[model samples]
Target: MIYSPPRQANFFMIFSHGNGCDIGTMDTFMKILSDELNTHILIFEYPSYGLCQGSVDINKTTVNNHAERAYSFVHETLHWPTDKILMYGHSIGTGPACHIASTKPIGGLILQSPYTSIQNVITGLIGFPGYLFGNSYWNNLETMKYINCPTLFIHGERDGLIPSEHSKTLYNSLGHIENKQIILLPDDDHNSISYTMSSSCVKSFLKQFFPPSNQLLPEINIDPEFRVPPETIQTSSSIFSYNPFTSLFNLSTVSINATQSVYNSMFSNQYNNQ
Candidate 1:
């Protein structure tokens, strides 16, 4: 489990990641979110992923079981209040998030680069009918109806693999959920949303529940190596107008010097190579 202690924490988060990623891949991302929101975060490794020993089955039952175990550890073992817990799922992680929230009480839920269902994702990719197999693996679109707490959806506008439409449809499907917001990052793809703009969107979404008492803290530095190239700036499935560059510099807590230093390092390496 990964955790970040806050000066004055209002909530704790249980974070689940996507397929092929373990806690190691999410270390920095989780830390960034924890620092920005000033909350303790618990990142659980799926069965067979990372050091957790279990079958590598990515089915509904196993994933839900993992979510249950993690929640129990935080709620039963750690004794955190039920209402003070938040669930965050990214990509395939949305499966367990929806599974747990469908039956449990949580302060809120955050799904990043989510899918309607794993079956839907497969159909969208291969053009094959998912119903042919009669599987309902990770049916978040259906499970969402049972969630009454605040919900936040973050997706990449240029996400081709799962498409932003999946998240849009999921949002629309949550008919009576008044406290829900969908944010689509224009310049990012499925894999880049967290580093690009997840923090800003999360901070805004969390404000209604956990109002900021302290000034925005300095941001954790993102790896400079993953900068988006200019050539890939294509339009995505965004219904809202967005400018990524402005968002990057206008962050509530990110330092101008740090941003500049990242750019300087990138440019210096390029110049030296030339």
Candidate 2:
């Protein structure tokens, strides 16, 4: 495990890396997240990946066991609050992250290049039926229904290996979450998202829970190419909607005053692509 400490961290982020990436390759990305959010981070190597012992275990059961162990190391052993810990998963790491979130209480979740399920990704990639892999990561779609925390979805539009559609599907499934955001980078591919994209939008999502002090950073202008999708904000009578064709982040004219029936219809129509 690698720990990067900040003077006054809002929370400790438990980060999971994608396939073929261990803690070493993720060092630079860890530094970037830490610097952007002013938070401590813990990144660990998977079994048999990098310098770890034994064989690689990508099965959902084994992966969930590993995630529980890490959670215990920090929350049980070190005595961190369950509500203050955030789980972040990239690519295959989303499997374990979603598993832990379904079983544990967490402040938030961040899924980068997430998929509805590995089987769905496989089906999309090779045109094979998902049922052929019956015992596979069966139901992230089902697990997501139980996770109601604030969430963020990040993906690259040009990701050839796992298309951005995966993230869109995952985002649409987050019906229980009151606050959520999605960012689609136009120019970035699977591997380049970490370095090519700006962390400003990520920090924006984190700040609602961890408010900054007097020392505020100046707002950085985001490049027009990186498209940040509409975020959902809860209100007394209705939910705020995202307008894709707008200049500002939150446009009032597109505000959706949804009754229960209208909300369902609006949400279904807005995310119909999934």
Candidate 3:
């Protein structure tokens, strides 16, 4: 899914969604980000999620391959400049976002509700040896060592699933990057970190890279339509509700699967040959 603001965009944000929701579920959120930050957003689905075709496999390698392909499609085919592209990942999506940021050239990176690694998350939550269950998959701590670009980490201080310490650990690991920041939302949780909750912080972070034009002043308030009353905000049980591992703890159901090409034919038909 792609969301382009009415005016020309200075940057492109390649977004990787969490394990639970696919592109279809993130349409509104993507639009909100694009409008608020004044950037074009290209958010893709993992294989077997949403309209993408394939069996469900939520490992680091598979998702990184998908994310790199999306970056190539944006840069090589769609012709977005490498330095003007930013990567944003949420939850499990942060794995691939970190992978691409470490390997590819991009202006910035944003990680939301991120974990240092799947292993660390498992270890922190259940008080067991993480290697016994998660291994080293999606290790953002190791990946952040290679990332030199401006990076922002966002997490809910009240996040019960992954915990806020995950983002703090990742931030501390990126000590070499001068332009790094971490924002912890006091009122948010795993599922409550919506645009309304972090819009100002995100906009402030983006301005350091893409300064607002005269026509687009900074500090503009979020649209009323997008704002949710604090009273209406409710924390969910978990954002990993669709993950298979959660089912082992009786938290949720099995992952979703589907049959289709790993790369959507739309991109091949329209851009691959171009």
User: Pairing residues by index, what is the TM-score of model 3?
Assistant: 0.77
Query: What TM-score number comes out for model 1?
Result: 0.74
Candidate 1, overall lDDT?
0.71
Against the unseen true structure, what C-alpha lDDT does each candidate score? Answer: 0.71, 0.66, 0.73
| 2 against 3, candidate with superior TM-score | 3
Best by lDDT: 3
The true-versus-predicted C-alpha distance at residue 78 of model 2, in Å, is 1.3
| Candidates sorted by lDDT, best first | 3, 1, 2
Give lDDT for model 3. Answer: 0.73
State in Å the error of residue 243, model 3.
10
TM-scores for all predictions: 0.74, 0.73, 0.77
Sort every candidate by TM-score, greatest first. Answer: 3, 1, 2
lDDT accuracy of residue 100 in candidate 3: 95
Reference-based lDDT, residue 215, model 1: 40
